[model samples]
Target chain A: MSNKAKHWEKTKGQMIITMILWFFFGYVIFMFGENINSASFLGYPLAYYMCAQGSIIAFVVILFWSAGRQEKIDEEFGFTEKEDD
Target chain B: MFKGKFIDNLPKIYGTYTGGFLVFIILMAIAESAGMTKETIGILFVAFTVCIYAFIGWLSRTVQVDAYYVAGRQVPTVFNGMATAADWMSGASFVAMAGGIYFGGYTYMAFLVGWTGGYILVSSLLAPYLRKFGCYTVPDFIGTRYGGNFARFCAVCVLTLASFTYVTAQINATGTIAARALQIPFELGVWVGLISILLCSMLGGMRAVTWTQVAQYIVLIIAYLIPIFWISNKGGYGLFPHLMLGEEVARLGELEAQFGLVKNSAAAVKEAGVPGGLKSISLPHSEVPAGGMAAWKFISLALCMMVGTASLPHILMRYFTTPSVKAARKSVCWSLFFIALLYTSAPMLATLSKLSLMDPTLPTGIIGKEISAVMAIDWVSAWTAQKQAFIADFNGDGILQLNEWFMRGDVVVLSTPEIAGLPYVISGLVAAGGMAAAMSTADGLILAIANALSHDIYFKIIDPKADVRKRLIVARSLLVVIGAFGAYIASMRITGILGAVAWAFDFAMSGLFFPLVLGVWWKRATRQGAIAGMITGLGSGTAYLIYVYPKFMGNPAWLGIDHLRFGIIGASVCLIVMVVVSLMTPAPDSATQKMIDEVRIPSGKTILGKQH
Candidate 1:
């Protein structure tokens, strides 16, 4: 594959993984918000606690982590945007 | 403080500004304790904040073409993130989000998820590529990618309509804040807000907007957090409420029971709602498969918002100011991180703030109590005087029930401090923050519409040889014209700010999302195919919006998509038509194909050349 396509290949691979994690934290858990309510932690239902804080925090981490992976992909395929001196 | 380079001196300038703001808060609090009138404190809060924004706008004022449109393409990532966060936190997120979560329960989180989830798509799919494409507007992207003026014009029309719908809503929020803060009429307050909004953007354009948004974010976050901190501490949940509010979620339920606010599903709402009776609390008109629990009713609203967030022209425009493609990508992470600061706290505020109102032991807790007694309370009487809240006793039992009470969601965040009986200064600070939220968003939306019209429609299309000074003149003029028009529409009260915002998101995504995404990813996407897809998508979405509207036929939703979720169908049809049409037509020229590859690579200098 050409360098451009290789960069895209690695980026796409990471993107698929990121999307799954994003979906799981954002949707799948929230969809089952009630069924998981009985499993209480910290004096709150699991679902409520998760929705209130955990998932949002998860989103932040996922964003940064995805950026880090993209940097690696960019470097591996020689696609890094060089800062002008 | 260093004066040679503003960018290098950013910390010094903003640090002093922040310190000065803290001192101002201290003075406001002291003045409140020293027996200052509430109205004086409120006006001072607003005047001080707006003056600060206007000062920044004046300081950044420029006639330079690049700076006017894209902040000279030199904003730092973190500052851009804060600005984007402020831009994202409109009247909806600042004021209505907690209320949405408060009233709708778990299902309302779809918005929180969808909005935040959208940045992931932005970071990976759009922002970096758009930054690499080096365009000033979304329509510029459409025009270049699709290779035609007609496609760009269609994109421009939908952008203006959707963004105008959005701008009017923000102005409505500003009017609400100004009306309460200044004791002026709502319509009059709208004109006041419009002038301040225009002052922030008209002078320096996006450069002014960028710095002003950063300042606004600071004021808003402080205002948002202080009340939550006070409520949590007062309620024994501690300062870090989300971490320790273990049973407080359950406390909300206990409080709900005590207030007799019970309803299992949308079916209950139907029985409880009086025909043509005044009801402003937003209950979803439809249900989802989350057990028909009503909490899950608007799950699709979240899904559409995600796609909509990715497509919004104003939001996409923010990335262009970043220093590099990578910076633009990381800025999405920062945007969500800053946004998360407020969003994660919204549910906490939702439960705790409701508890402040519902806990019968609390002095302001009025539900399930006698109507006359509740009326006598100062905050209750005050909000009721402004027509933001209502209480009626229907059962002749002398006690208030859930059915006899109503409150506008827009007022909940503003009124929470008063309801919780905090210092009047905190309420003033919140009023300042609310205005900041509204004005900050209005600035961005106005600039987006004005820039697209001035840059793409005026400069590029109508007069390609237009100079930098002429373009700036046209842009600023459009800002004033549009701002006044928006204020007029806002005074009419077309719908609640949140409802208008939802429609804006639906319209934005309906027409723009598939074309934008496919433009970058699929080089086969032809100009004709894209133009056809945009028109059909937007047209179908508008048709669905009308069909479901109560004043119209009120048709039942097809495939369970309501008016707010019409993007789901619009985008689906757009993708299918785009794919089918692209294959049936000839490919774009090699130049356009190569331009696609250049954006995808994300390295080296931008494909488009420097500004004149």
Candidate 2:
């Protein structure tokens, strides 16, 4: 495959991982939140903290990690944007 | 000392801006004690902040298309993130999300999840490619990618519909906040807020909107945080509230048990608002589906909002303003960081605010108090006079039931400072912050639609050769017309801000999500397929919304998907349709296929656009 194909594959593979994480935190945890609420964390229901606070914190980490990793991939494939306009 | 570029100056400028704003707030607090009326302080807070935005707008005004449309494609990553955060957080997020949590409980967390999660999709699948595509507007991408005016026109239609719905909600919020502060009629407040937004954005287009939004973000974050920190300290949560919010939630849960306050039940009549005139009379956090439907509702709304975030024109437009595609991707991280500062605190704010109100130890506590005495309390009487809180002696027992003392969700944050017995200046400050949130979002939404109308519909389709001056003039004129139309709808009190925001997301998600995503990722997507996809997704989604809505058909939702989540059905149908049609139809030309391949790469000139 061409470099273009490789770049696209690397990006798509990263995205698939992202979507899985997004699904797990965004839906799976919340879907079973009732059961999760049976457990407590830091004096609050576990599911509630996950949804209201922990999940948002996770989203930030996910985006930043993906961005750093993608930048590395861009460097590997020489796809980084030129500095000068 | 600072001879560098704008990016180099941002921290210093923003630091000074923050310090100066703090000094001004302190001055106003002093003035408040010096017999400056509450109304005067409120007016000063709004007028002063708006003037600052207007100054920034004036400084940034331009006739160049790139500057007007994409801020000369030079916004730094961090500032773009700040601006995007401001633009994304409308009146709904500032004034209503905590209120939504106060009312909706766990299910309401969907807004936090969906709104933030959508950025994941933006970073991974959309923003980078769209930036590389190098279009001025979202419809520009559609028009060029699909190779026709028809596809662009359809995209424009969806963009306007979605954005217009959202703009109305912002206007509603602006009007309410303004009306209370300025002692003006609600109808008049709509125009006051609308005019401030216009003054901020009408002069400079995206350039002005971007800078002014950055400034607004500072004011809003400052405004949002002060009350939280104050209440946190007073409530014994100390300076770092998040560490102790779970304990507070446990306290609130205990209070709920003590008061028999179950979450998500249909509110009593008085609290629910007027009798069927606008469902808002008691617009709880959302149509949180009950029982087995709860999980589906959360997932569905979260999915709808996430897709909608990835697809919104105003949001996507922010990415185009960044200097590079990498900047576009990185900005999402910053955007989430800035936004998360507020979102993470929201549930805590909701918990702490609710705790203060329901603690039964406070003088304002009313759940079990006699209705007559609760009605006589200063804050209660004040809010009652404003009709924001209604205390009814429903049972003739003359006591306030948990359900009897009805409060508008919009009032939660607005009333928190008062409930906490802080200085009225904090209320004025919060008002300014809420206005900043509403105005910033309105500026972006109105500009998004106007850009679509003028850039896509007028220049692209009507007269491709219109001059720069002519194009800018046309865009500004359209902004006035659209702003006025949005204000008129808002004045009618159509629905609650949060509900309309949900509708806007659903509309955007239904019509634009699949087509835009496919245009970037799928080489086989044809013009015909794109057009078919937009129409079907939008059409089916809107039909379901109206069908499931109580005011309309009142039909039962399929698979527990409420009207608010109609985007799910629409997007699914659209994805299947677009793929099928692409396979059946003749393939797009080789150039188009190559363009698709090029969009995925990040290091070159935009295929469909000109570099400055």
Per-residue lDDT for B1-612 in model 2, tens only? 567887679889888889999999999999999999988999899889988999998988888888898898889999999999999999999999888888777778888899999999999989988888888899999999999999999999999999999999998888988888788999999999899889988889999999999999999999999999998887667678887776667766666667665332346453545233111212222123346577877788888899999989999999999988999999989999999999988887777777777767766566777777777778888877777777555566876655556677777888898888889999999999999999999999999999999999999899988898899999999999999999999999988787789999999988999899889888899998999999999999999998999989999878988878889988888888888988999999999988888888889888865732
Model 2 alpha-carbon drift over 4 Å, by segment: B1-4, B262-291
lDDT of 2 by residue, A1-85 (tens): 9998998899889889988998898889887766778688776688888877888999999999999999998999998888775
Top candidate on DockQ is 2
Worst 10 residues of 1 chain B by lDDT: B280-289
User: Highest lDDT, which number?
Assistant: 2
What TM-score does chain A of each model score against the native chain A?
0.91, 0.94
TM-score of 1: 0.95
**Tens-digit per-residue lDDT, B1-612, candidate 1:** 477878877778778888899999999999988999999999999999999999999988998988998998889899999999999899788988888776766667677777787887788779999999889989999998998789999999989988998999999989989988998999999999999998899899999999999999999999899899898887677768878776667776665555554443445445554322134323321112246333344356666887899999999999999989999999999999999999988888877766666666776677668888888888878767766677755566988776566666655688787777788899999999989999999999999999999988998789999877788899999999999999999999888777789888889888999999999988899998898889988888888888886667789887667777878877877788878888889999999998898888878878777783
**Which residue pairs show backbone clashes in model 1?**
A43-B246
